[model samples]
Target chain A: MAANISEETLKVSYEQLSDLEKEFEENEVEIIRHQVALNKPLYEKREKILSELPGFWPLVLEQAPPDVDQYIQPSDSAVLLSSLKNLTVSHFEIDNGGKGDPRSIAIRLEFNENEYFEDAVLEKKLWHRRAKSGWTGLVSEPVPIRWKKPGKDLTQGLLDLVVKVWEEDKKRGPGAAPITKAKDYTPAQKELKKKIETVSMGGVSFFGWFGFRGFPISEEESRAATAKDRENRRLRAEGKAVPDDEDDEEDEDEDEDDDPYGLEIFPDGDELAIAISEDLWPSAIKYFTSAQETGDMSDIDFEDGMDEDDEDEEEEEEEAKGGKEPPAKKRKA
Target chain B: MAANISEETLKVSYEQLSDLEKEFEENEVEIIRHQVALNKPLYEKREKILSELPGFWPLVLEQAPPDVDQYIQPSDSAVLLSSLKNLTVSHFEIDNGGKGDPRSIAIRLEFNENEYFEDAVLEKKLWHRRAKSGWTGLVSEPVPIRWKKPGKDLTQGLLDLVVKVWEEDKKRGPGAAPITKAKDYTPAQKELKKKIETVSMGGVSFFGWFGFRGFPISEEESRAATAKDRENRRLRAEGKAVPDDEDDEEDEDEDEDDDPYGLEIFPDGDELAIAISEDLWPSAIKYFTSAQETGDMSDIDFEDGMDEDDEDEEEEEEEAKGGKEPPAKKRKA
Candidate 1:
């Protein structure tokens, strides 16, 4: 007979089990809660920065004309100048063309008081171009700018400082308060604005100018261009608007009537008799045969009599439906 | 005087420039085509495989009875039979127990003959259980069958072979074709059919006996059971179920609420508490307070008195708006 367990003993065992289970469940819940707590602040901070940056754009734009506006009013330029009035003036310089007229132009620029020495120096150089015009004006060159630190505020400070420097140079130059209508810009300012416009339009890498070029064209675009060129040539041959260039005359010599191989073009100008490089023919054959098997003949145009084997297979299939067996296979000699 | 260059020499240089440009463009187009050729086969293979796998489900389901469609089926005592047909046989066996004679049952199952060895073995075992009813009748544990090596036409070969095996087994056993009505089923045929259904339902695992014990109880059922237990206890305490046993009860401890932690019993008599560990509280509080100061309060429930500081700050802001200067240096001593 089984021994009877005491109620107190049973209760103690039950309490221990209950405690273990409770602890396990609480740990699970706490772990999830702790992970959420750890991640929530980071997620919120990222979201806040993203939202605030876009909001800051409007404030930045308030100090300058809209980028898309073709004409920048002198009043808009004045507003831009006023925004930078409290910035510290780093230096005052007048560019005297070596031709000996010191008073020919005098321009003064105030750098942001909080800007670093290197940034202030760069801003001073950038401002010097704002005083010239026409062929004699300075041309804009891509210069690398390094930040003093990594935070969003520091990056924004640098951008604001650059804009302030440009504003000061514009405001202090020449005859009128509204500088846009002043009828003349130092050739340098005009060139700088044009370069800025190009950068904004192309979004090309600055490194591209120094042997990097632009991002390579995508494969899809290249293929599309080739296909379009092929189609244009075809349409022109059929009397379309495509111009008759020398290449069109060359293409006519390579049209093949019964070429089993699917070469798009032949250098020898005789598609049927032209020999492919030994290395290329195997790949050509594989492509053609696979395409034929898959019924994807759009890439290759076969002559009527060239695909006799396909026709024979179709005829045999029809005969089989009529209760006739296909012909015996031919034996190889 | 500077010498004038000949038109022929200039034309030759111009032609060479045009040729170089044309060659560069052609090379770019060729590179694009080669890339497309490389990727095309992989895409085609992926597409082909994706289109083929979805067709296997219906074939798998065909071996089971069309109507026996529960993810889990329940039987008396929760003893799940290996197959739907076996369940039917068990039901018949239970129903016929009171009768003088055991009833004869026939089961038929169809399955893919070319499946792996484990699958065929499982199928055969499940079907055999219908006829055997208990563990004493089989020769050995069934092994899943697979197609022969170089598996061409193996599906048809296995189907024919299984039918032959069933016929031979029937011929060797007496009265194996047990039917009240006139019918023929060799013991092996009945066994094979049951196995097929089993294999279809459980695959190669053959773990039908455990029968999904870990499945969660439904919330509704749990709630109902708790309510029922509470009512029954209440009635018993009031001397409704048994009057004599009531006086035999020891002093009922109504001091249950005296436990300081307020632990509660769930319907299943499982206890839960929301108490924090005394050892961890100091560290938790320090971590939480530091997180709050750093704008990273992801853990604490600052839902009640914690917001009082924020309200006080708002009041100070309102006073400041009304031209009162904020107090400086209110650091705690």
Candidate 2:
């Protein structure tokens, strides 16, 4: 049947499939390469955070993932001085909570520790229930740490260590992907994004970025994970190291792998995805459509060196292409 | 650490965990039982729809899963008159898209065909662009439908068959889960749901319904899905179905299986989900939280038989129980 996704293109001609395929392959590698290069350090930080956060800041285990070691020990922070912005400490616990499995990090900062504390320890919990940008604090558990005396050298070591860790975290990691809530888009872009967000409020979901999309799995992943289900099934069949208790754990892993194609935004995307994307964001359609048409990415400026003069040519070419109905761009021989 | 997911009790009391567990176990079976009874016919329709829809609306193959047979002889519709509302046909296509491998169902409605036709097919694509109630349309391709002439006895039989199919579809089938765009929620419910929706817009997910909470996985389903995967894998191994071509499909299936509990709505719903749900839907929280406390579901009114008088008594009992923090409902023999 004739399909109309948007006014600009009533139907994607059958012939365009070849073009779309070519376009996808031509740029996917490079795009991924670029993303890899860009997100390499971030990914590393994410890994390190996964490893380090659980050991010291087990409360982070609630919001962030803990390595096997971290999970075993978990975080039991005695003095949790959160929201250190201008010394506005939120929650400080005497009996550090490290016992709970799969702990939740978000807690209403309580003032219960005031009675147990000495006169010198004046602590306040920051709710942050309405904290704006650049004001958000990390969920942490600095367990087993006695609040060091202000002048005590013992406290300095703890303070310095905490400082170093905090500085490292400030660099942005997985738990805080695109951290600090920095608005990267322009005002117009922000408005457009808001509109998109409003429109996409429905319970649309992508399962997880585990197997579907190559989301940089590390060596330290759980034994239940990393090992393929087939391998696990084989091990179980062989009567070797098949843990029954971790059935829930394996189920948890599958949950992460829920998304059909591991596509974060697009659901079951193909040419249909192209149509949706084109319809939703018509302005950006040219990049995908034109690229598909000319499987020759020779015209694509990955370097973005297209000058003003070339922009005019691009528009004229687009107009001429649009005039050719049913099929916009022909197969480049 | 103590997690306070509800205002009634800030932290999920340890004692309540037992009660909650009991409630979940007791009510879950019954809730699911109730659902089973209510949706028995719907489920049958769902099965029938899965079987028969592909025979006619194989275009649904793009959106729905293709049975093994559908992969062999796909739909080849010559004429498609879509809209039944005032014969306002939206997309009418002659050459249904079925040639491409692992085809994407997106089509372009040709204006040229309008002039060629006998002043009949004037179709308009419903983007649902402005027709909000949270809906939007995507263009699709349906092929291999044999066209029936307008006034032929043979066409009458075909039309009768189509009518029967449509009548079956009218009942809420699995494929057509609550069609016709009716508002299922009241305004207050909508507002509350929006709040819940807003709070739960993260990348959280659940996996297969296995052993976390009893998520209704009969022994039969596992065998079937596992066998299918094994068969599919075997086919690939034998070069009968090398599915590098459909990389996305496998992933999508995983996404569907993300929630370990497979709590269709709640993704990886632990305490975080509880907090969100409680904060958003306080009225619903009693069922979940109290369920866990008693491990006893005597309080649960699954039948909705508790009238206004019983509702008052329930409230009084709840209040009386509330005073006993950390120990709400005692286990009833």
**Winner by TM-score:** 2
lDDT of 1 by residue, B100-181 (tens): 1111121122233332222322221111111111011111111223434424222223243334543463465643422211
lDDT per residue as tens, model 1, A130-213: 110100111121222344454412222323333343455447763333223213444444443344444335332211111110
- Model 2: per-residue Cα lDDT at residue A263: 18
Cα lDDT over the full model 2: 0.26
Per-candidate chain B TM: 0.16, 0.18
CAPRI grade of model 1: incorrect
Note the Cα lDDT for every prediction shown: 0.26, 0.26
**Clash tally, candidates in order:** 19, 46
Q: Which regions of candidate 2 deviate over 4 angstroms?
A: A1-217, A222-224, A233-333, B1-146, B150-333
Residues A104-222 of candidate 2 have per-residue lDDT tens digits of 12222222332222323222121111011111111222212233354422222332333333344445564552211224433433343343344335422111000011121222232
Q: Fraction of native Cα contacts kept in each candidate? A: 0.00, 0.00
